[model samples]
Target: MKIHKEGFGTIITSTIIAAAIIVPTVLLVMPLYPVLGWITVIAILGLLVFILSFFRIPGRQHADGEDLIVSPCDGTVVVMEEVEADEYFKDRRLQLSIFMSPLNVHVNRNPVSGEVTYSQYHKGKYLVAWHPKSSTENERHSVVYKSGDKEVLVKQIAGALAKRIVNYLKPGDKVKQSEEMGFIKFGSRVDLLLPIGTKIEVQMNQKVKGGVTVLAKW
Candidate 1:
């Protein structure tokens, strides 16, 4: 699979950590394998953690169309309901939330082929990603996309464990349904607020693939 460009730093840092643990264990502790076998096991597990955390999977492909809607991130659907977007842009919308566990790929993808009309990052507190209050209260980057007449909002939110929220795309940038937009560090979430009458394809607690699953359609 292709490693995402946004995950380069994560991969590099993980590699360095693995090297530090393995080389030192083999060179300095290999001679003590009989007595320090547990130490060797610890080193092996450390390498495994880094490998899993930094790994990225290529997004699944789908046919393109004007009415097509794509999943915004690779994670499990945590919230799916009609709710009011009360904070930045106050309006009633279909809120479909995806919870990004640390094990899942943290890269956020554009939900549709659109021209970004508005994009801005808000500095705020790190709240639990799944918390209902987190949607409007947590640190996040908001992106409004215009695909023809459709306007949808995607928010990259920081969880309690995630301190850094990386958004690479800016306002006015054209984005494709399958293109990468940003990566959230550690555990986080992505919320897509859609207009009324948008078909809800997925339900709460369901798993969804970025760019592969259709969450809504105009």
Candidate 2:
């Protein structure tokens, strides 16, 4: 597995902090209370490991097809329902949401190959990922991809623990299916607004991998 580019700064900062704390404990505290010093070392090291693991990009072949809509992030599906469109479309749509925990991979991928027709960021409240209002009220970046006659909107939403949402696409940019679109720092959720009548392949509460699992078909 390769570490993502987004983690470099964070990893460096964490390494510095760990060394600062570990060095003093080892020199001054370890000689007095060996057990406590060892515990401190272990705890700091474990936390550093978790930070590294959060940005890991595992090696795997991604799914791709013209009519297939792949999952944009690794998480468990928390919602699959038909709801009235509120933002861009202003019509009915099938909304599918995946909830990503702090332990889950945070990389977001493009679900289809097409030109980006809309890319907008919204500033809002940070609600818990599973809350019904979080989809609209939470901080988010929305992107719409137009492939032929179909257009799909994908939203990267920030949860209570997530503070940064990174998106790399803009209107008029061409994107391919399963390509990296952004990264969400920490825990969050992703919402896909699909055109009504789209065939759904995944079920509620199902686990999915970014760029690997087939979510639906055009």
Candidate 3:
């Protein structure tokens, strides 16, 4: 396992805060209110652990195939349906949405190996990740990947608790399947717009791991 690069600043800040609280509690509070001080210490440590866990990247063999599209993030599949893509394609597409909870890993990966053709950031409302309208209404960074003749759009959307979305790929950049494409701070959602008539491999409400779960096939 490895800590994500994105968590360094957060982890450092949390450590400082934890130390500030723990040192004072141990020296001042523990001398007077031992139980309360101990409780405070445990609570602060637990929160710090959770913060570290959020950025942990566990080692695993990622799924890969020439025609397969892997999941781009860890979460539960909240939406799987056909919809008219209004932003980029402006055509019919099969949409798959994954809702990332605060407890899940928030790193986003590339679903396929291809050249990035479109990358754009949209400023919008911060709706809850699982909300039906959040896919289009929430602030998001969208990227389109082209492999051979097939193209797919992936959107990193900000949820109520997620205030920042970090995307690394831009137009013309070559990305590999299951590689890091971005990271969403805190909880968020990811949307994939696949070509119509593509075979859907996962079902709604199914849990998926980024770079590990097979999402579809071309």
Candidate 4:
């Protein structure tokens, strides 16, 4: 597994702290409290492993096609229904939401090849990933891509545990299907609002991988 570049600073800082503080603290306690020292060592190691795993970017083969809509993030499909979109579309749209836990990869990807037509970031409250109102109330970066005659909107939402929303694209920028779009630090959710007539390809509670699983075909 490859470590994502986003975690480089975190991993380096953690290593330095372990060497400067944790290791020496363990050594000093080993003689008087061997068991406590060993436990501390294990906890520290576990934390490092968890942090490393959180940002691991596994190799992926992006599903490429002009009409294919790939999963934008790894998680279980939570919302798949028609809803009134008040932001960009301001009309009824097919909404597909992916609920990403801290354990899953936090990277976001483009679902289709298109030119970004709308991009905006909103500062809001941090709610749980699975909360029904999280998609609308949480801090999010909204992006819309226009492919020929079709347009799709994707939103990166910040969850209770997620503190940062990193988006790499802007309006007028062209993006390829399944290419990296951004990364949501820690846990969060991704929402895709498709045209009403688009075919649905996935079901609720089904696990999907970013840039791989097909969510629908436009």
Candidate lDDT scores, in order, read: 0.81, 0.97, 0.94, 0.92
How much does candidate 2 score in TM-score? Answer: 0.99
Model 4 stretches with alpha carbons more than 4 Å out: none
Among these predictions, the greatest lDDT belongs to 2
Q: Which sections of candidate 2 miss by over 4 Å?
A: none
Candidates in descending lDDT order = 2, 3, 4, 1
* lDDT tens digits by residue: candidate 1, 101-204: 88787777788898998888988888899998888889999999899987999999999988888887888898888677888888899988898899887878
Task: Give the lowest summed-lDDT range of ten residues in model 2.
Answer: 81-90
Ranking by TM-score: 2, 3, 4, 1
Quantify how close model 4 is to the true structure by its C-alpha RMSD in Å: 1.1
lDDT of 3: 0.94
The digit string of per-residue lDDT tens for model 3 on 85-204 reads: 988897899999999999999889999998999999999999888888888899999999999999999999999999999999889999899999999999999999999988889998
- Tell how far residue 198 is off in model 2, in angstroms: 1.0
- lDDT per residue for candidate 4 within 118-208, as digits (tens), equals 9999999998989999989999999999999999999999999999999999999988988889999899999999999999999999999
What TM-score goes with each of the models? 0.88, 0.99, 0.98, 0.96
Candidate 1 collision pairs? none
Candidate 2 clash pair list: none
Which window of ten consecutive residues has the lowest lDDT sum in model 1?
Answer: 54-63
